[model samples]
Each structure stands twice: as C-alpha cells, then as structure tokens.
Target chain A: MWEYLNHKNGNVLAVKNLRGKNKEEFNYSQLNKKITKASKGFFNLGLRRGEVVALISENSPRWLIADQAIMRIGAINAVRGCNSPAIEIEYIIQHSKSVGLIIESRSVWEKLSIKNQIVENLKFLIVLEDESFGDFLGWNTFLEIGNKNTSEQYEELIDKCSADDVATILYTSGTTGKPKGVPLSHANLLHQITNLACIADPKPGTSVLSVLPIWHSYERSAEYFFFSCGCSQFYTIPKFLKDDIKQIRPTVMATVPRLWEAIYDGFFGALKKMPKFKRNLIRLLIRNSSTYKKNLRKIRNIDLYETSFISKLISLFLVIKSLPLHYLASLLLWPNILKQLCGKNLKFPINGGGALPEHVDLFFESLGVNVLVGYGLTETSPVLTCRRTWCNVRGSSGQPLPFTEVKIIDENNSILKYREIGRIFVRGPQVFEGYLDNTQASLEVLSIEGWFDTGDLGFLIPNGSLVITGRAKDTIVLSSGENIEPNPLEIEILSSNFISQVQLLGQDQKNLSALIVPNMELIENKFAEKNLLEMNQDFEIKKYFKSANKLFIKK
Target chain B: MKLKNTLSQQINYLLKNRSGSRLEEQIIDLIFVEPFSLENNLLTQTLKQKRKEIEKKYDCEIKEMYKKQIKGEIII
Candidate 1:
C-alpha cells in the first residue's frame, strides 16, 4: 500500500487521461495528498473497520486511491473487473455486501449507473471525476468530511489493521456464473509481492508498462512488485497500451500469452505477403537466431561468469558486428511488433493467468527479452512460481518462490512421489484468508493443514520443477474410465497458426471434437502466397483439417 | 482496404475479387477464422459483420496486420 503511494509521490505514475491523448503524471507528494483525502473521505462515509466497500472504475489514479483508502480505514475493498457484464456486476455488489460503492461514471458503467437502485445495501455513491451522481451526495462532500476528521482518528483506525486484516476481495473471472471473491489480507499480498520482487528483481527506477487490467491478480501483484522495487509504473485509462509503451519504453512488464501470440502471428502474417525468397530468409534468420541463443545460454551456464579469455574475445568480435545483426532484427521487428500488440522494450515479460504455450515463451526468449512463466491463483496471493532469465524453464512454471511449498496428493490424501501426476496443493505464507462470505466454498479448498487445493493436476519434475498439465475440472474421462489431459493436445492445436481457439468436446464420444477458430489472415496470406486465392473460402479450415489429419492419431 | 466497410466485408470483398472469381458465390463446406476468444467465434459465425463490432473485437489483430504491412509486406 505504501509502495503504491510512493509510486504516485515520485511523479512516475502515468494515468492515461482517456479524455484525450494527453496523460497526467503524478509525483509522490501530490498523489499522497489525494490518497490521504480518499482515506479520510471513505472513513467519514461511515466505513468501519472490517466493513467492505466495493470499487467500480476503469484504470485511473482515483481507482488506486479509493482502493488504498479503504485499506487505510481497515475496511476491505472489493474490486470488480471493469468489463464485467451488468448481471455479474450486480452479483458482485450483492455478494460483497458492500456498504458503499466508489464509481467513475462513463459509457462503460452507464448501464449500471443507477444509484442505490441496483445495490439495496449501498448507502453512498461517491463519484470520482464528475458530478454525474444525480440526486446523490458526491465524493467532494465526503472529502470535506474526511478533511474535518482529526488526523488522530484516522491514524487510530489505520493502526488497528494487522497483517491478517482482509485488504481486498478480488473476484475471479468466473467462466460459469457469479464470480468468486478471493479475500486476500495485507500480509498475503505483501508476501506474494516480496516473492515476485525477488523473482523478477526489477532495478530501482525500472519502468513497468501494465497491459493486463489492474483488476486481475497478475497485474495487481505486479503493480506492487514494481512499487516495492522503487520502479516507476504507468497506465492509460481504459485502453491506450500501444501509445503508452512507446512513450514509456518500459524496462519490465507482465502479460498473458495471447498478447505475445498475437505479436508472433501478426509478424508471420505480414511476412507471408512478402516475396517468397525474402519471407524464407526472415524465417531462416529467426531459426538461426534461436539456435544461436540456445547455444549461448548453454555456454553462459557452463562458465558461470568466468568465461575464458579466448571465448570472451570471440564474444567481443560477435558483439562488435555479427551480433548486431540480430539486434537490428529486434529493432526492426520490435517496433512493429510492439505496435501490433501495443507493447514495447519490456525488459522482462512475466506470463501467467492461464497455461502459456512453450513455443510462445521461447519465441520472445529468442528475441533477447527474458520471459518468465509463473503460476498461481487469486487464492495463493496470486504468485507461487516464477522463472528467472538464467534458470528459465520453457514449459514448466519454474520453481516455487521462496517460503512456498508444493505437494501432490492422491485420492487417499497421500502425498505422491516426485514426477507423479496428482492433485497440486500449495502451502505458503501468502495463501489467502478465505473466499469472502463463502464459508463453505472456502472450507472445501483450504485444509486445516494450510494446504490450498489448487484443483490443478500436475507433477513436480524429478529435479523439483512444477509442470501444470491442466485444470482438474477440465480433465476428460474416456469410456475406459481413463482421465485424459486435454491441455497438452489443445495446446498443440493452439500452437498451429491456422487454429485460433480450441475447446475439446467429448463427455462420452469415441473421440474428442474441437471447436476451432481459424486465423483467417494467416490462412488468407498463405492462400495468396501459394497462388490459391480462388479457394479463399474454407481455405483455413481445409488447411487445418489437412494438417491435423497428417499429425493427429486416428482413434 | 478502407474501401470496404468491415473486416468480414473486406474479407468477403477479397474473396469475391481474388483471381477474378467470386469465391463467396461458391457453396463452401465451412468458413474458418482464427478464434482467439468465444466472442471472436460468435462474430465469425454471424455471416454479416457490423462495422463497430468487428472493428472493436478484431482491432488488435487488424492493427497488428497493418503494422506488419507498414514494415513492407505485399498483401496480395
């Protein structure tokens, strides 16, 4: 919480004013005053210690202020995803039992903008930027009340908060129904941020450009991680990722694999329209560069910063000229590449949120940017495992962070041996307090032994590496009663440039059928390159089916 | 490409004009688009695309393609 304030105080937090292309930067002192006001305001709004206040806003400085202010009041803040549908939004407000809501009125929240009508328990609606809270007391009035409160009163409430006091309730994107609110405490969050900071090791003044919505745990932990390291953080309101990145030239960032995949697909799609020889040459360069880097990683690992003089001289020569060839490739490809996915010179790109394709990780790793693949849920304070540049593992989620323990358990509650696939349970300092208001659900996942059942199936490698196969809930059972891991096959199909999305369908069928989304541009460009323009219709499906027929084993 | 109003429209336009034959007129077994999300699949399934929906949904991929083109790829 203090780190967030520090980030703002330092004049480095770029709140992309979506009203126009113009962005406003905040210094530590200016931001802290607002945070302190926000804290006082929320307290004056009758927010008591242990009460919950729901925050509904897009990415903005006010959002952070409202969030941290609730923490300062010893009240838990429940954050809803900005893109949440109305029904889901209402469900969150009800489930969280939020006494009040802090909202920023815009086209996005206009549908749910009815004050007090949607949330019966809601007492006040504090508008952040505008006086659009019709027939309601505005945030400015609340600010005045907070200003009137003695500093001693504010400090008393803040000092009452212990590490165990719930800080926030983050609702997971429930693919099925009403989202589950994961309740994390101050200690849970700080511990996770500490581990993440250790893993990424961002330098002081490291600039981080965040694309993933701060509503998500991945970005939330990352925001704090950057803060703890004294790094600068910048974000645009709503969505201005592309413009923000070029302007920021961020030293570190975190994103899901889809962003990286889009960059890869866009590059190849454009290349397909190039002259055949030129296209082939670029592909050759990518392959050669990957191979060369793979060898360099091996050489570096062997020497351990003690390279022989001869090898060092060879490296000097390579750096002087030949190595710059790939550097130029990065320079040429990265700008357009960043423009494609709206990212830039991110020093370290951490991947989480879902299972990431190894090929996707390697593609960026090949580009000389260290890509760290991590694993966690909102319940684990969000970060459990993260890879470093030197000891990176492509497919696995890397080793558990310091002070985190992992165990695989069988049906009898027996711990499985290493390299054996079983249910994954994690014990760590940062595990969440529990799901908000869902005592039954919380009991089911969290055991008395402090192991949180991750509901993910995987095994630790013989060398103690975590390999997540698939969600236990997503496992497909065959007629022979054998459970099949669908992720491996689905991941392979997803790796194909032709297939965009894949979901395996078969509860009892002889074999699985997939709902596949084809990359039309890639297929269309391929058709154009192959002189098969006349067959553009159904070309993507045909090519994919043809490729699948050759590779997939027939049942 | 701006001559076309929508991405699916541009795609159909390309298919119709490519090789001087209207491929859209042909009875095709299936139409495929790389589906990144459930929303993408829904949009592709809708035979006619709304300019706003297509533009908002596929903005990232489309802009990425445009950037690649800017870097000198000849789109057939």
Candidate 2:
C-alpha cells in the first residue's frame, strides 16, 4: 500500500475530511511521512512486532494512518466499530490480547477504563483527540516521541514485515452467537488489491467516498484497494453524506443495501411531493427508461426476466417502435436528474453487506447509474464475487472473482447442480487463516481440504452468477416438515409501498406468518385524504395488509 | 385496542380469500408493534432483527395469539 503512495506527485491529494466550512486535505507525501512517524512512535511505546493492537474509531484519514502505521511495524490490529457495545469492545480487547489501543475519543476510553482489570494487558492508549481525561497519551504527543527515533529503525521494521505475516484480526458482527475473530494475513489482503485492481480498473487519482463503517471487512478491503490505486478518499458522516456528495463529486463509492434503500425512498418520496403534472411527466420518463434498459438487455441476450417466447417477441417489437422516445428520455430527462441526486461524476457505486431489493436495483439502473451488488462474508476477505462493468445482471450476484472457486452443497456434503438451492462454500487465496484461538469453531465451517462454508443458502445460475436465497440458520421448518426460507418472502412483502419492513415467523407452526411494520406516514396521509379523521390502529393495519396482498400473492 | 389484537384481526381478514388445501387454510396470526429498533435491543448493530430477543420479549403476546387462533376466534 505504501509503495503506491511513494510514487504519487507531492501535490496530488490523498484524503480529504470536510469539517463545517473547512476541508482538510492530506497529500500522499504528507501521509507517507505521518505514517512513518506514527510507526516509530508506536515502536518507542514498546509496541513490538507480532503483538496485537486495538483500534476503536469512526472512519477518518487518521484511522487509516494509525492502521497502516501498526501494520508497518508488523503488528496485528483488532478493529471494532466505535458504536459497538461496551461489553463487546472489552471482550475483544481481552480476547485478542491487544497490547495497545488507539481510540477516537475520550468517551471510548471511559467505556474501556471501567474494565481495567480485564484489559490489564493493554500497556498504552493513544487518544486521537486532544481531550485528556486520565493517563491517555494525545495523538500528537505520541507521534513526537517517535520523531526521536532514527529513520533507519523504521526502515528495519518495514523490512522485517513479510507478506505471510498476520496483519489484522477482524471480529465478525455476531448476529447469532458470540463474535468470532477472523485473522487475515498480508497476503490475504494483498491478493484482493491486485485482483480488484485488474477487475475494477480504478484509475489513479479517482475520488472515492468513504461512508461505510471502516471496521467491517467489506469497507476495509475496499479502502485498502482504493488506497493502493492512489485514489483520493473523502470521509463523511451520515448526516453530511448528501452535501458531501455534491461537494466532493466522488467517482466511486462503496455502501450497504440500507443506504441504497434510503436513497431510493428519498428519490421517489421527493417525486411524489412534486406537482401532479410534473410528477406524472417524470414518472413516465422513468418507466420508459427502465423498459428501455430491460429490453436492451434482452436484445443483447442477457435476459433476466422470465416471460414466454411470444411475450418476449412482442416486447422486442414494442422496444424497436419506441426507440426514438427511449433515446429522447434517456438523453434529455435522466442524466441531469441523476446527477442532482447522486453526483454527476459517479463512475459506479458498489453495494454489499446484504441483499439489495431488485426493484431498487432497477430504479438506479434506469437512471443510468451503475449499481453493482456483490456477495461475500468476512472469512473470504469480504469480496468473492462482484458485478463486472460490462456483465451486470439485475437479480444475480455477479460472477466469482478471477481465481476464486464457488460451489453449492447439500446436507449430505454432496455437490449440487446448477439452480439447486443449497449451502454455499468457497475456496480461494483470499480466504482468512481462521478464527483466532478458536480451533473447534473454525473446524465446524472449514473443511480439511480448505473450503469455507459461508453459512448462506444460494445457488448458481446456468451462467455461473449466484443468487442468494437466505441464511441457513434463518430457515423456518413448519410443523408438517416443510422448510421455507424467509428472506425472499420478507423481501417480496417489503416491495409494497405501504410496508416498511417484515419478518416471517412460523417455526414448528402450521403455517408461516409475518410481523409487518407499516409505513405510517403513507398510511396516515392516505387516511387523511379520505377524511377518515378517527381512524384506528386496526383500520390502518388492515389497509396495509390489503395493499401487501396485491404484491405478495402475485409473487 | 391492543396492537396485537388489531394486527391479528387484520391478518385473519387478509387470509380469508385464499383458495388452497387444508394445510394452506391455516390462518396467520400477527402482533404488530413499532419497528424493530437498535435502541430497543430488538435489532443488531447491523440492523438485522434479533430473533431470539424479539421472541423472548413478546412471549406473552405470542402465547395469547396462539390461544386465540386455537379457539377459532381469530378467523373470520
């Protein structure tokens, strides 16, 4: 990673942080110097090679500097989100045997200071901000200590680091049981940087918006890849995301499905608030553009929708007839609107961490925005398969990355054929070493031959793209012994405009049922328009269910 | 007026139009509440629903809904 930084021009910006009216830019040359100084400072603090260090912070340029510095000294970092529960943070510190900690704020220090006995192995604490509470060392103060060290010492430490050295231990955000630590080596991460560079081909000096939690492997690996390409990254908080997009005009971004959902809602919600005639005009244009793209895909032999031959023929004829109008709409209406919504400079946006609704995918694609949805777990260095720029399918997770092998298997451990939904497993150079200090747990998911069971239920299409159905553990078995995956059902139900979220529940029951959370704003507005002044909760729920059935039964 | 009763009644009404086998005739019982929120301990930090936590928290309401379904009072 540091090799790419060394060759960049001194004037070229590497990272920018927007603070109110002021923007802070750290160029590559300056960042390289700071990283070296920080590494030396850590060395002065008795942080030896092969010891573990913990990082608790939000996304910032300093966060990357601290992480790179730790890696420079051949130390492993155990990163946790700043918002993690106090208990989980303490548990990670003790479990990883982290010798030092680099925290964002004094509040985080307070949270960990209470459990000092459990974290007695922690010898040093470097607080990023200057706010002092206890025995914590300030960030600048710590760096000044390293200034005394000779440059030869820093070079020696970097030379001692090897590609096979364990670099970081990333803890999974446990949704089921206790969080497990996934230890990844430098080679494991470096492989992704090289592979992704070949696949994505991100140009040097491209601007990337850093939004997702940096602690998560999906975002972390992408950050390392972007930095390796010498791209300038801009960090923003959730509240300032919209404003920052306009100002930064980033060429690339990586985010989760929830953030995409919010953008979808915001776009359509704003459309609905427009005047009636204007609203209808934009909606018509959007529908035409969506159809144009779908028909174009079919014409190009990338058929995603299921339809009869006769219907497809008719659709093709219609598409040919409306080619003029489609071109007009695409050229005139969408480009500016998309730019206003998400910056005009966006080359492509990557979505991961969860399944993106197909409708949401279509909505963005219609506006000429390239939204690539990938799938992977933390154990696979986070990205095993991602949609390529040219071969993006609407509903399927894109083809596996080059050199990665993906296969599906049944409960009997036999490989399943294409289109058969089963447990997904992967083997690749990017796979992590194993869970830290948890051999029994690691053995449960990993086979002797090296395939890691992803614990996700999915199947490959005839074209080799994977479609995830749901999680294996989340499956509900009815009393009659029929197994059902709830994710697809829940996603289908959520497509209704009146529904906000849904969870299916029917374990050991006669039939599956769902807990629905209605979009109260839409319901209340509709009721008010109907002059139903005294509407009750029962009436609102019934109205929502009636609308939901129209979408659900069709599926 | 309870949220559970209102949701159960609504679900029962919605399933009345289904035309399927006897097994499919099983009416769905629901207990509506506010959205699952992270602050409420019903959702994880990643925004996934914490199933065990939610099931345990609403144990009483779930039992009442099951009893009402058994009595055939929830079906239209």
Report, for every candidate in turn, its global Cα lDDT versus the true structure.
0.63, 0.75
Ten contiguous residues minimizing lDDT sum, candidate 2 chain A: A528-537
Tell me the tens digit of each residue's lDDT in model 2 across A374-403.
Answer: 877788888988877788877777889878
lDDT digits (tens) for residues A143-167 of candidate 1: 7776775657667888888988888
TM-score for chain B considered on its own, for each of the candidates: 0.36, 0.59
Q: Where in model 1 is the C-alpha error above 4 Å?
A: A1-23, A106-110, A113-120, A135-145, A237-239, A294-344, A475-555, B1-76
**Backbone Cα, N, C clashes tallied per candidate:** 9, 0
RMSD of 2: 12.7
Q: Itemize residue pairs with steric clashes in candidate 1.
A: A9-A27, A9-A28, A10-A28, A11-A26, A11-A27, A517-B35, A518-B33, A518-B34, A519-B34
For candidate 2 chain B, the 10 contiguous residues with the lowest summed lDDT are: B17-26
- Report the Cα RMSD per candidate: 13.0, 12.7
TM-score per candidate, chains pooled: 0.69, 0.76
Candidate 1 TM-score, C-alpha based: 0.69
Model 2: colliding residue pairs:
none
For each candidate, what's the DockQ?
A: 0.07, 0.12
